[model samples]
Target: MTVKVFLATATVALGLMAVPAFAEEAPAPAVTPANAAAPPSAADLLFEQPQMRNAAPGSTITYDYLRRSGIAKGPFGAPLQDTVTLKVEKPTVAEKGGAGTPSADARDIAVTMFSGLNRVPAGPFEDMTGNPIVSLFFENHLRALAKVLEANPRYLKLAIRRGLRERAAVTPVKVKVGDREVDGWQVVTRPFAGDPMTERMRGLDDLTYTVVTSPAVPGEIVSMEAASRSKDGGELLQEKLNYDPKAG
Candidate 1:
């Protein structure tokens, strides 16, 4: 089965410099080097802190998603699961091009998908593969959290205007990961409203949903849930996170 994902990109205007207009004969005031403003710091420019500290290099995080369609129902529907391994490598120069100096917050993560315990490598996220879906979803969640942590008005505005579509608010929630319960925050996307979709699909309207992340670990997304309606309204996708110490 193939599923289509739509993402919206928004462009924001940072700030405009005021250019003084003077008479034709008049000369502008001299601008001294001392008057020039310094460049933004790394923390000011980019999110310098790790949102998912537990997902460090060489660490493994596994997630399982329950997908239900017309052919299947309940939790026993078509199996969708994946395990992501964080690569212990420095950020490539190419990735740092526009970002200028590199920061410790950059991450290189890879994911592999499984169907009922069988390995499957369909394609990348653009191909709408199961592996890509789980990986990209978490990636976006971290990016959104980073923006919120940075507290940069301009970037926050852009993030909201773009795909994230809403500022994350802290709502205390507890979830069962394995045997123990984990406390986290529930951040809902576009909480008040929903975005209109250009294309129609069964059991789906917009991509708006909610995600739970561990506050203790900052950026570790514990679970996600989104719903749509076909002939019947049900959960489109539900995912949970688990830490794998033995994964390599």
Candidate 2:
């Protein structure tokens, strides 16, 4: 199916978050295709020093977000605010799938998310929940960041297949988190070449996602933001990273 169709299906599927619980497994890391005509060099794929993978198991990053629906400011509206914590865990085994090679030594880290004090399950949805769209958004965002940090080109292709792209330009940006000001690269990825409706349905028009990574630590995503608006151009969702500190 086309990326637009896949994104629409994804949004619908995400609406049901209360799916059946199954055994949790480590997420697979991205890898390059063996038969590609041309491939990136090891240096091109490797993350610089102080990578996200270097974080100790207990390190945590927190973000604060707000969701609003309906008119920007009027009756029949739904607005909510919450916090999500991403905790780093020890390396785990990588999932199967990739160039027929054993993934034995591949780096697979487990990063779990918590909404308030409730643990969010890993993997796709199976049932309905309150705000599955937002949850799934963060999950995919972080997972994609993880793969990119590991220098996997396949991850970019996977994102394209899922309706995201790698054509976004990297721009210099400054962001404030808590009391500190961070200088990083703002990488924005849009849908593949297509009609505007596809972009809108995928929330690309309503929301602009920017991944911020410090140049000092190339692949580490220091912060991210999603600014969204309603169909009628009203405010909808606001998500921003609040704090990210190394585990002491």
Clashes (N, CA, C under 3 Å) per candidate: 1, 3
What TM-score does each of the candidates earn?
0.45, 0.46
Per-candidate Cα lDDT values, in order, are: 0.36, 0.37
lDDT of 1 by residue, 92-198 (tens): 54454644544455434455555445454433321111112333544443343333233233332344334333344335556554545655545455421342322
RMSD of 2: 13.6
Model 2: worst 10 consecutive residues (lDDT sum): 12-21
What is the overall TM-score of model 2 with all chains considered together?
0.46
- Once fitted onto the true fold, the runs of candidate 2 whose alpha carbons sit more than 4 angstroms away are 1-51, 71-78, 92-112, 116-119, 123-166, 190-206, 215-219, 230-233, 239-248
lDDT of model 2, residue 44? 19
